[model samples]
Target: MKVLFSSWLGEVVDNRGKPPESWSDCPAVTLPDTFGKDRPMSAFIGWGGVVVLNESYDIVETAYKYAQALQASSCAKCFPCRVGTKVMEDTLYKILEGNGSDSDLVQLETLCGSISSNSKCGIGQLGPGPIKDTLDHFKADYQAYISGGKKRPNYHYPYKMTAPCTSACPTGMDIPLYIEQIKEENFAGSMATIREASPMASSLGRACFHPCENNCRRDNVEKSLAICKLKRFAWDYENTHEVDMPLNPNKHTREERIAIIGSGIAGCVTAYNLALMGYRPVIFEKLTRPGGVQLTGIPQYRIPLESLDAEIKFLEGIGVEFVCNVTFGKDETFQTLRQKGYKAIVLATGADLSKGMRTEGEDQGYEGYYGGIGILKKIKYENAEIPKYKTVLTVGAGNTAMDCCRTFARLGSNSYIVYRRTEKELPCDPHEYAESLDEGVKYMFLEAPKRIVAENGKVVGLESVKMELGEPDDSGRRRPVPIEGSDHVIEADCIISAIGQDPDIFYMGDEPKIKLNKWDNPVIDEDTMQVIGVPDVFAAGDCAMGPETLVIASGHGRRAAQSIDQYIRGEEIHLSDEQIMENIIRKIGAYNKNEKVPNPKGWERQPIPICDRDKKLSSFEEVELGYTQEQAMEEAARCMRCYIVGMACVISDSEGGE
Candidate 1:
């Protein structure tokens, strides 16, 4: 990671009257400097976006200045913004301009409320925040503004809506570190940086939804950096071209037995990190093979079985033990696990069940109807239940739906996707959507199932209805509203319902009575991943969250490890305010001169090579060609180094967000 010194290229005179030293002579202003370990006063701290201060500081002046600054800085993309920001600026300026009206103050408040709720994105959503804080803290000054008077000292609030991109990411990865390493052509080093944070780098590179990329600041420049592909490139380069970097040996002789449930990404990740932390990890997988949904639900063509195997092998090498074909509730419950002398149990049995369509004939033995994920598992394991239908209809627009469609493609079944929402509302990755289309999988959007249009308990076709977008639903995509008298029918030999799946806590079977909330989600503390009442049991991944992506589950896994370790040590599951403060690495002072790296602007993103459409459609092999070394290096150069946004996160009330 490059330490940017551009913030202080000029002169620097301290409080001392002596001549200021050059940047080269002074120590770099790093995050740790903000700790006030010795000097903390000047470092500002903000509470709920307000810089905390007492009566000695004037609140009105700072609030007005920032309110005006925020209005000016807004991108003015939406109507609420283009009009609202200008109105806010003019209103504030008038208050400062000494001829402000009472209506002007009221208007400012109204604008703030409307903009916060109605804006398309953060620009309008947060632009009026300072004024809101002003209304709360500095009402006297606003009254004075209306009365044509001046307040001597006004306080300033911290900038709201800063570092939103970093907050949206699940892992909260240091995105810039690996990018900078890649820019320096340290491919192996880049991989090491990624692995330092996440254990499933290669698998994630190929499959992750990459919420980080969605929140990337680089998108404002052009396209977001090819972050996920670059991750894959680093791992691929290491696997084929570079030698493995030896790890510093763990010398501690403490042996703590940690039992992890399931073999999904979360379980694997927990076992991986626990092993690295020098704990003895015993992973229990109910299925014959490991990798959980990653192997069974996800087809091998997208993520080769070997790629996942290599990651599992890496965990094994780190002293993690994998026990396969072992059911948790039946083979061994928490009671049995405790009797085995395990210190803690991590329930990572992710949302592996495929949801059923409660349509007609679904309850009984409906012929040719199966869960999409069930069919995927059947295909992966070469089970007798593999679809033999001539035409298959997969219901859902998520990645799993696409996976099922593609599976049918390779199996020579003409597949059609039945999504109630439009293509714009697709939940699947764009790459998967495009590839599914390329492979001749047809789409029937804006239409959803009414029932299985069956005959004599045999699924022959689907009764459907046309739908139109109404208002945005909870998921933020437009809700699909069914149109009256718009019923339709579609012919298909088989139907796979892929609407969604939730964790199967039913596996618990009333044995130890592991706590579960009304939603059937395991009741785990958000901060600790510990079951609400069960001190010995911790849950992560889909079991905790109904159905999340690989990266989110993996992130939960790491947190689970941290909390379980803390619990084992007889520590609080949640960090105290002081403990969290001591743990943070704050960036302050002048940046280092030597660590500046090359700028990553205007470098066109190198497109990842896809396998020939003909070749991809013909076989159930890996469809995407791995990046060439040259392509990987060029693509790595496109990073905007968004980690600098994390620097703004320095003087917060607690630890980092996300």
Candidate 2:
């Protein structure tokens, strides 16, 4: 029978005149219908958590925070919540006060429609609940306030959209909104908001090179926004807390077929997007299983198959058909696909072939010699043609080399990386390289292979020479210059080259009419993702461009999908990469000049839970285990949403009054 009322500023007062120690266990938190003008207005709370707004907080801010919370809480398995909530929150800001126009309302409604209909989980599917309710219930009130209902204040106007964190995010996520959501303990809602731009919530939460953090407004105060880590936290909570991917209501309408080449992140994401577009995309993969390089090349210590498999299955349930044991060039060609009436083709085959050193001994008589990609493939397939040698030497300092070195160590082989440049010049992500060191992989920097030594036609040692940093190379890194008298030999049983890779474009053939770049990669219209001279042929991923990260390739896949959809529809596409870049510049310019927002505080680095390095090296059962539920939730609580909710209009006091 006891009752309590919680204030808009988070003050809770009870009938006994004070709040309980554990308010959640209290009988009730009720609100009064009316109050004096100077006093805080009691907002009504309908039965069953139906929030009734009556206060003077910014409406856009309210909607944005709620949307962010929903996104963060979202499971990130479907199209609607993963991308829609972000668009909704970002768009709602333009409707606030000064920058707001009538068109914004329409845009918000459309965004809400997609989220409600297509989102994969209830968190995202229902995140728009408060927004829709507010618009419906308070439209007249909003209109009255905007159209000269109350006397306009004489405050000076400044530019809007000034936060760097918002500008840096590719999905235009409302970083400020979700951070506020977490602060309010709307955990599920926060996940929903994050799903809008990034579906790999768990992956990104752990591994995203967070550009947003660098541009955070909080850096001015103390530390930058912990945007990426917080996202990881929310994703961890939902994944560990029994989140499920919702079934598509329109699955019966999926008739149009799409073909996506490759099975890496790009292909997977493309298929996921196409499935959402109501097309059943059959992914053609060269391997027996999906997860191209992500499964085979990437060491299980950093990324586990269980999470990868779970995501793949989620896509499969959404009408995406995956066919393994089929390569595009050999098993089937582009012409064969056109004959099959496939509406679109997305080439997402990642760079699988490793580049070999043009130096001597490349084809030497050795019992155990392999390329980086070949070695990785053997490790993945458990094919023992690659002998379990006693000593191993890996060339190059990129992620590929690190992966091979660590993989060799797990296979009970002593491994060492021989890089021409110093440790500072290593191309591998610092985290991956650090882990390799932990697994007893040795690094011999400033060393380049001179020749492979042989003993009775069997490889005995790798002859190498020490080098010094020279002039900056084309890649802007210091090139290595071999010292004349620094030749040395390291005894090894095998050597794996991991320098780099070029596209396998010969498969496209001479008469196919597709244009190739100087590097022999397919030359495509960057914006349209269309191969030159081949009207219907689209290219994406590493085979199209040179070697790139999984995240960049995923972006290409999505962009190519959009371009392919347009080509299929017979529409003249005008949005080029230049235009997209220009728009980004303009948006950034507009955002950078606005007044700054307040940044939240005290965020520590969210660590990925894992077993001891020694214990992890004994088996291939994933070393850097994913975030636990508690770790992820606490990390998610640290996000400082960096977006501005209201745009300020600059006008003379006399004009503002009217």
Q: What is the TM-score of each candidate against the true structure?
A: 0.72, 0.68
What shift in Å separates residue 403 of candidate 1 from its native position after superposition? 0.9
> TM-score of predicted model 2?
0.68
The Cα local distance difference test for each model comes to 0.70, 0.63
Which stretches of model 2 miss by more than 4 angstroms?
Answer: 1-195, 202-236, 250-254, 382-386, 576-583, 586-602, 644-658
lDDT per residue for candidate 1 within 65-182, as digits (tens), equals 5555555555565788778777777777677757788788788889889976776554565445545765655576678766876744323223322332334545545556687687
State model 1's lDDT. 0.70
lDDT score for residue 400 of model 1: 91
Least well predicted 10-residue stretch by lDDT in candidate 1: 1-10
